[model samples]
Target chain A: MKILAAVSRSTVARVLNCIQVLVPKPHVAVVSLDEEAALASKAMGVEFIGGPLPEKIYAIDEFKEYDVGIAALDNDSINISVVKALRSIGIPLVISLLNNSANRDLLVKEGADYVIDIDSYVSQNIAASLSMDKWVYVKPLSIVNLTLAVVRLARRSILGVKLGELKSALRSKSIHLMAIDRLGKVISDDSVELNAGDIILLTGIESEVYEASMDVEKLFRRHEETLARSFAESLRASTRPYG
Target chain B: MVFALKSRGKVSLIIYLATEKGVRNVKHIYKSIEDSISVVDTYIVYYGLGAFKQLMDIPAFHSEPPYCRGKAILSGVNLVTSPVIVVINGDTSCFSIDSISNAVAKVLSGETLLHLSKPQTNTDFTNVYRSFLQDILGELGITQSMLYPSYSIIVGLRKFFTTTPYSMWSIEQLAAINLREEALVVENNSCIDSTIDYVKGFEKTFVKDLARKAVEIALQRNTISRNRAEEYLKRIEAA
Candidate 1:
């Protein structure tokens, strides 16, 4: 497919890199004011349009034949203007790189088919990685306004408790223990005992699931705290004060 | 940067963590953000009984038994004394200091509210939520194509959040208020509400960077305190 890529400054490299991976032997047309970008585009064997974007794009007659257009400029206002112009000119698919989060919805409203904020996307992925243990899988049950999350019950306090006993608490948090995995075995039965290392699948809304997970952690901590306190008390009672 | 902000003396950030799962996620999130940017006060506003006695010294609020989204937010808001408050979901990944700094900049620059968007997933639930939100906004005379706020990261003036009514519909209400104020919308969406998402996120370059950065920043801030950030970094390294 013929592609029109509009870039400004350092973003040219990132945009070009992405395009290279997306299409083998890509016939992309690059537009930018950066001389280095023009040189880079020439090196990549893509058509180069060296000038200011959005306005420069409208001047190119060959742009009409392009199936997709990408506005990956660093400036939000320029990106928005260029994407708006691209959309107005009937580019079937237009994507814009959003540098600022605040401009995301504004660009979307401007008719860009897909708006990506690279920073947010990357950071979100990073954030998700940091907290992987809380929820294994989260599928939104659209019809029920609930999300299904596969959670590992890592807290020892909640171990050995029957699912039936935790039912009321889970229910109060809007969570349902749909299934449990105990040492490679999946148990759908409610009466099975919960173990410290068992994987428990839960379903609830985002808020509900969050609360449920917190409750589970609390149980584990409470168990540990009590054990620690009792052990400390026994040691104190068995020994005399040296002071 | 949380500590940096505190040291600067010109500004301060109060981070409100909304949780129902107790301290497991909160502890990790707190240290990650602290490591990534040691410039803020992190508060744990929870619905659970108590597992966070260590944070007892830190100002906190307890939501009434049986969690409610609205109450948690409102309770956190009531406790916030900073000019700006960042209300983050406990389950979502903690944002880097730069992200929070950017949000504060927008807040200071006349924007009334800033809502961070999550990456859009083509899930049945997202479609449903989008359609519902679009229809509701349409009826309210708001443009359907306008930005919709994700509940993951919300930053605004202290009074704005504290004064708003707390309920399950608070997010919607916050969006509506944003519409009236012409709020800033940033896209920084990451919610691991499921195993699938968590796995996908773990496999990404940024997620790995997050763990690494957490360690680097933690070590830079305080080598003596082997906090959760260190623990998480070790786990990531081992994995």
Candidate 2:
């Protein structure tokens, strides 16, 4: 695709790097009035369209031939003008960069097709990545709104339950027991004995899976605690002389 | 988990957000899908904002500018490594998880595209417009019972999306073009495009309840950050 990027020298590297990843073999032409910007574009072997703001963008004779145009100038007014010029001439797509988030509506009104604000865009992505461990990170996990969670059985009572017995219980909650990690190995046997410390991998809606995990943990812990209390009571009764 | 296991780093889900209304719609979509966050591999939520920061404070949404729906769909399909891609307009909301699952199943089961068609839900004028659309498609030698291309929820294969040139044209125009062969239509989904629709739509059974359920699930799963999800629910209450 042939794309025209109207950007300052500072943003050239980042823009080009993003284009390389996103677009497959884009024929990018860098447009800037700055000689330094032009030199950078030239060094990168990009087609350089040189001149001032809106005027230089308007001067491109073959504007319609370009598939998409990008206006990434740091100055909002200049970027707005450049985007406006591209749209007025019927560029198929015109995307502009925003320094200030406030100019988003104005740019869209001025005929820019898409607007991207750098700060919020970058920070949001970083934040999402940092918070990844708490949830699933599959490439398409949230598309269908499914998550993967691995829960370990901590108490012995619940661990005695066989996978066959638990299948119907899990199915009732719409949770699928995907794999069983016995010691260090992954097993898929339905008759596999339940053992404490075994990790069970589950896939289902987040809420349901979490609920199932909580229920399993609570049932096991409560059973074990009750069993211990009853044994102590029996011993106390046996030690009484009147009995 | 085995079924959920992805080969290599292949993306299993692609979410392209059409951001004409802003990022609130994007947040709404994410919130609605909170209950089923386990099946997704990765998601790309690009606001059709070219180079500007987003007006709405949805941090997880990426800001990618596209000229129109076509460009956004094409761009998203190109950028994401997923085999399945879902295109949703930010302004439209209120689709059931079952509807989404059904659509995804259809795509994975060999349907080229699934169009979430809520026929006859709009006004008389829109119905007439849809009939006109059917006539236009007829003239183009495309014979279909219904020609209204519902843009609320579109599910299809990434390859199918990339090969089909559905961009350049509006939803109706793309429908008239009739580019794909294995497209399926799903019905009963609803969208709130305007204030009137919002009011009208909510007057229906369980609309508010569904929103409440979505908010609750969103909070429980941390699908969106707690603060953002709560803030959104608060706005709805105040409204």
Candidate 3:
């Protein structure tokens, strides 16, 4: 669909570059109140408009310009204003950036088509990384998937057994062990014994995954907490004023 | 609507000083203004030391010395001219500096600052709560979430208890205690111990009443008519 994105210059450039890598060259229009942005977007093979906002808004009307108008501007007020102006013209699919949670109900009440909270999205990913077990930080998408997490095992731990033994132990739960990653590299063969920091990627439903991961997480939590506490203590001691 | 404070017939310059965290986005905003408003003059003042350094390095930007604090710098600018001085958070991931600047410009020009409501982040909650309090105190609207004393109170408590030997009280705990203490001080006048407590108690009541007044003002200003606002008030009362 033809998309008209109103954003700051750098963001527009970054978004355009990201879109270029993901989708085929699409009919995209970058509308900004800055000339440099228009030039930059034009360089990236997107349509650019550099004029007064109302004039630019009117200019888009001549062409079967855009189906979705994304007002990803940083300011909540401006995003809402742009959305309101677009909605006034009967534009479909008005997406906006809603930063503050208090404004969500108001934005919805005002008829915003879609509101994306980028901060919440990033924070959720960060929280997921901290909460999950045996997950890998997928560099490209920054998505923490189950496959990349490290599953900790103690020397005398019940799961200290080899991969085959652990698989057998987890068999009652019908959990499928997909792959094991150690120090960032995935091990191909399943015969290797599970050691400390050996993360086993498992595929299962919510209950199965929770049961399996919770066991590992509980075992590791104490050590992790101890290490964290000690590290914090050391940091504090180092920063203390020396008389 | 464009209130030109200067009689020099020159376009008034509105300098927006953003934190270093927001410099990259603010530069785009500067460029957008240059493109859109052919007559008006504009400059950007970056607040954070790091942001100031970055702006100094950029050949395009005419850098001024870093402003130590965002509000202080904004107030300083207000002293010189009445051009809209926009201040935004450096760490904001959602919007660019230019968009905020544009919005501020609109507000200064007497246009409505229309904002869409979304879910509040921890930062948003802190900011909104603080602004809500400050607005009640009849202060100029403060937008940045970090500037609120409540957030600092929480951070101070967290650091003091968790990282330092101050105590086991987290910032959240301190905030709750402070809030409860203020509430109790307002409710029971007998517990007033110090001048600070009395001031805080008065401020709390004033802010609460001001918030109620603000809601009334918002209702009047809202697109919904007086009848609708009254209906809303009735529904709220019924609930």
Pick out the ten consecutive residues of candidate 3 chain B with the lowest summed lDDT.
B151-160
Q: Which stretches of model 2 miss by more than 4 angstroms?
A: A1-243, B1-22, B31-67, B124-132, B139-146, B166-182, B190-239
Docking class of 2: incorrect
The C-alpha interface RMSD of every prediction is 17.4, 10.2, 14.5
- lDDT minimum window of 10 residues, candidate 1 chain B: B194-203
lDDT of 3 at B168: 14
Scoring each candidate complex against the real one, what DockQ results? 0.02, 0.02, 0.02
TM-scores of the candidates, chain A only = 0.57, 0.51, 0.52
**lDDT (CA) for every model shown?**
0.57, 0.55, 0.43
lDDT of 1 at A100: 50
Per-residue CA lDDT of candidate 2, range A129-167, in tens? 444113222212312556555555544525356666556
Model 3 residue runs over 4 Å out of place are A21-24, A51-65, A75-179, A188-191, A200-243, B1-239
lDDT of 3 by residue, A16-109 (tens): 7755774656677777877778778878888887653423564566434467777766544445546655666666777776654334444554
